[model samples]
Target: MILARVEGSVVATKKNAKMTGNKFLLVRPLVIDSPTAKEWKPGTSTLVVTDSLGAGEGEIVLIVQGSSARLAADDKDSPVDAVVIGIVDTVDVGKHILFKAQ
Candidate 1:
């Protein structure tokens, strides 16, 4: 799993039959400055992920890829390469608290 922020969403009126009702989100992966740092920085690239947990824009989320993503989706056979698996609450790295949800 990887930490990411939901930057926006994707609307696809026409898609695969298995993905008819699925929601898609645009997310940027979050990376820590350092092991001892308490800050999270946005990754350079963005990704579109399937969402079933109703995650909104600006929320930090957890994402899974490949076969794991398929398992996280409502339909296991959906052609999903990435999926939002969880909405992050807090991120604690050792003694430093990296993030907290409001």
Candidate 2:
């Protein structure tokens, strides 16, 4: 799974039949500054991911990519290459709390 922050949304009126009602979100992958640091650093690229978890903008989410993306969707044969599988409530590294949803 990849750690990402939902930056925005995507709208598509016409798409594949297998993806008719799915919502898509713009996500920026996040990486921790270090193992001990509580800060999350943004990755260089962003991805349009199918939102399986109803994650809103600014919320941190977990993304599953490649063939696993289809597994996270309602349709087993979806064309999605990436998917937002879960919304993160909190991220704790040992005694340090890296992030907490509000």
TM-score, every prediction: 0.94, 0.91
Quote model 2's TM-score.
0.91
**Candidate 1 structure lDDT:** 0.92
lDDT of 1 by residue, 1-102 (tens): 999999999999999888888999999999887756777799999999999999999999999999999987856777999999999999998887788899
Candidate 1 clashing pairs? none
Clash totals for all candidate models:
0, 0
- C-alpha positional error of residue 45 in candidate 2 after TM-score superposition, expressed in Å: 0.5
- In angstroms, how far off is 18's CA in candidate 2? 1.3
TM-score of 1: 0.94
RMSD of each: 1.1, 1.3
Error of 1 at 94 (Å): 1.1
Residues 1-102, candidate 2: write the lDDT tens digits: 999999999999999888888898999999888766777799999999998667999999999998888777756677889998889999988888888999
